[model samples]
Target: MMDGGRGQVNVALEVLADLNINIPVCGMVKDDKHKTRGLIYDNIEVPIKSGSQCMHLVTRIQDEVHRFAITYHRTLRDKRTLYSILEEIPKIGEKRRRELLKKFGSIENIKNATYEELLATPAMDGKAAQSIIEYFKQTSEA
Candidate 1:
């Protein structure tokens, strides 16, 4: 969820940059303990300093993205779910899925992660890592 949050912040920032949504943009940051801090504005992070600003921007973004998600983004995540890492080979069943999740933790970690790190997991192999790369490519296309 934190990774997703970071991505959302980045997307909002990019939208502001590209479309010139000049509302003062801030990022909701999490501390090392994984606690919700405040926000970062213009590279200077202020913990919960601009929660209202961040909330307003996020709400606006959700409204806009919800409007467009089905039309554009769905086409991508939908197409790729079939070829996704854990779902790629039929041989990888429920047990393997649980094991993978237990080992790697989350999808974002598995995605940004290197093949070597993946292979280092107990019982995970090169073939699984390759499948992960294939899934990553699909998601990136989205």
Candidate 2:
């Protein structure tokens, strides 16, 4: 499943083809006011009624897909910010950064974690844990 108008659908199809993916793709398109108006399948328009069982299902799917995509994007953005912050602390490379995120879930959680908890994370040692704690402290103080 995909979202957007004709251009986006075309791009998605091209990208998928490059990746060797072959599957039916359908797009949920929105009108100018950002209302889901119809489904575009294989370049054919399936008009959706304003209020009907089929429309209800399409709306639900569109809403859920949009929410999921936004949440995923936000998570990636947070991870990038966290990774940049972690890079400032010595000895915290990609592996350590991933371990920290996996353990604490977020940068805020990592900042609030106890020294012992930080040390308990995979690939984390006492020095690395102390560096992370001190980094957050210095940032907070500034």
Assess every candidate by TM-score: 0.36, 0.65
Give the alpha carbon lDDT tens digit for every residue of 1-142 in model 1: 1123455667777877898676755555766875445556666655544357755665566567667867787767853563365675434655656666677676667678787987776667788767767777787899
Badly placed stretches (over 4 Å) of model 1 are: 1-85, 88-91
CA lDDT of each prediction against the hidden true structure:
0.64, 0.88
Model 2, position 138, has a per-residue lDDT of 93
How well does model 2 score by local distance difference test?
Answer: 0.88
In candidate 1, position 114 carries an lDDT of 86
How many residue pairs clash in all the candidates, one count each?
A: 2, 0
lDDT of 2 by residue, 1-142 (tens): 6777777888899999999999888887889998888888898888889898988998888889889999999988987887898899887989999999898888889899999999999999999999988988999999
The alpha-carbon lDDT assigned to residue 118 of candidate 2 equals 93
The residue-level lDDT of candidate 1 at 28 comes to 54
